[model samples]
Target: MKIFIKTFIFLIIIIPLRAYPQACCTGGAPLSSSLGVISYTGENLVIDFSYDFNTMKDLYAGNSQLNDKQRERSTNSTILRFTYALNNKWAITTVLPYVWQEQTVRSNVGKTVQSSSGIGDIVLLGQYAILQNKKNLVLLAMGPKFPTGSTSKTDNEFGLLLPPDLQPGTGSWDGIGAVSYSRFGIFRPTLSLYTLFSYRYSFQVGRYDGQQEYRFGNEMVINIGLTDSFLLKKWILNPSLQFKYRNTQKDENNGSSFPNTGGSWMYLVPSLDIELSPKIYLHSNFEIPIHTDVVGTQLVTSFKGNIGINYTLNFKKNKAYKIKD
Candidate 1:
């Protein structure tokens, strides 16, 4: 029994070290409201947009033996963001997101299969530049997640199961605050640190439904640039590590709860942004779960691959009228 306990602890500590690819979540860097560090000056305006899709299949340890017992999930997300320079001292930014998710579960007896689908919540954020210079920086951001998604269980699984929006989106008023700093060393590459905090309050579920409330946890991330250059002058690589701490929460009636549900994770996440002309570029990353504590008899998930594109639109400056010589 003692040996088993020690082995379990060892697995938990070693799993997150395999260096997963830096996908959107999983092993990637924390989400930032900033477009990236300012490499140029002027009243620059940028409109950044992207789409992401993810799917998970056959989740859980007993799924293989249970025949019909299985779980699957898929998600599609779209984000539209805008940034404007309020002089060199500060800037303002906003992000609008739309998400669609689907989940399917099968019973062990092969007697029943359940599924749900719907839109998720929407979020808005604002950012301020607290400090900026040639080699160091600091920034702050705050935002709210609105209950714009479908909370009605009718949208999913026979009106009996919880919808993805309700299960993951936290159907309540919530706020997020973040602080980030980065520094460049003369002998090496840039290093960055980020911390995020979130708070949520549950809502009353009318008369017939049960009331549920939960307080999520906090997250911290650190990133180190392994190399400042790659493949000549058009590509760069960065490796980073991220840690998440989750607080315990429970179902009031059941008295069952998830403990230490949060764990630390690490990944190599090498990102490449290629310059395809000045207006278009290609970006991609692969995140693999090296270690995770989200394991058990029920289900487990790991990191995967992500690839995408980016386009920049530059408004042309008006040319001076030529006078006859």
Candidate 2:
């Protein structure tokens, strides 16, 4: 039936994100969380909305876990993604985020808390499918991140400027590139495997009315995952497990490396998806940090979780554009 075909197409989106792109210590939107999971084989417009909650209390010092619980930070982010297929081979996507961050530092004297909330940066990308078929797909995406958010969110306590990590936006233009390979039907029609590689390059920008210049670390991520679906008459359930490794280079200030700003991280993510209808789906995931190594002592994420919904609006397709493999 028509619903069956749509359901088949929707199964391609079962990818669990690299999940948290912005480190818990660095309070920014997790822009790369959903970038590589979109599907272009179908002729339609897909809208995805997600809310991510991340908390950090563990400290790491050069591959060693520290027992410091004096500082804690958490970020709440609401992200919306729109993907519109241009044709069978090309598409366009945009990501918008609204973020809120809170930091707490406790001492014997008392505790100091700082919070900031506002819009985050936006990303626009162009996607091209190098190969597409029912059983396999290869996709490439590249884009630039626009500085559309306010870098002016100040500290709630002193009204002074918050650090770059706590600011709503980075005030810099950045570039992102990604590639993904996916294959399904390995014995079972409802089973699949996928891998994604992505990188982000950051450019320096002036801050505080051009008085100081700073740059976040360049980042690279690799993800591999497996997903399987179980059919239960009228409903379907998809469960997935993903392994993600992320490397972030040291940040730069004026021209020098900034300490405690970059590190290597690995996570194990488990996700579940519920197909509500031919057009609607529910997605949720939990991220657990298995390993972390950082330069200097820095607070790292203890755990992260996100929930979202996906809706696809299908349009009439031009069969001629879809190449047969």
Candidate 3:
């Protein structure tokens, strides 16, 4: 009877994990649309807002016999972002997300399930341009991530099952630093290299339960872009490759043991930007995870894609106005 009870508890924990699969990267692509907002800022301060929606589904079979099988799991999320350029060299951005997730499991004994929905983490970031040159190159940006989301709720069955890294509200502070360089090459092709690093440490406070100390291991993202601009045509095509590496760390029930869950991932991202009018344009990109270590054997079977729309409101200066009209 004791053995059966322990097995039942284990199954409960595994079921939710199998259902959610864990979310690694933030929704959409690696590059932020507002990253370059300051570069094009005019008078009156420019503001841009974007919305993205993503949907993912997955099915897994544990063994060859297919006896240990799981049905499909689906997740839908909507993210809204806003950016405001303070000047030509600095800007601030924020993202708010809402997620709806569902899980269904199937076995010889029949089927079991759970589901939940809530507001995800809220991230506030700032960008600063350190250097720029009109003809050849530019270097910019870095910021911090504040814990504005909630973390107190933990549903053992359904609802927003929190990952170790994102527990709704981490109740801790974190910092991120990044630098990107874009250079113009021959044939009008632009080459850009971006590198980013982030770290977060959680304090044992409030409803932290035990002396569980949580720390986000070092995380890095590298992106290389090949972009081309066509003369007279308001269109730009950028094909890029992104590489990500994350080292995991966890400590619970004191400082006895902490296992490492490190992994690397790579994706191919292609983006197209077109100008609809003078300063209005539509941008979109498809990011497909091609290789990964954290995904295990189910890498291909489980993948995510993002689509977003951005609207830029550019500011213009009034040259005719005099100081004392």
Model 2 gets an lDDT of: 0.76
Better of 1 and 3 by lDDT: 3
Per-candidate alpha-carbon RMSD to the true structure: 12.0, 13.1, 7.5
lDDT of 2 by residue, 40-122 (tens): 55588889899999998887777898787777789899999898887778889898989999877665545667678988888
Number of clashing pairs per prediction, in order? 8, 0, 4
Candidate 3 lDDT, tens digit per residue, 25-109? 3311222322332344443333334443333333222211122335544445566666666655666766666655544555545
Model 2 bad stretches (over 4 Å): 1-27, 317-325
- Backbone clashes (count) for model 3: 4
In candidate 1, position 228 carries an lDDT of 38
lDDT, candidate 1, 182-261, per-residue tens: 55454654444433333222332221254543333333443333223334456533333344332212212123332323
* Global local distance difference test of model 1: 0.40
TM-score rank, highest first? 2, 3, 1
Ranking by lDDT: 2, 3, 1
**TM-score for model 3?**
0.68
lDDT of 1 at 292: 38
- What is residue 41's positional error in candidate 1, in angstroms? 4.3
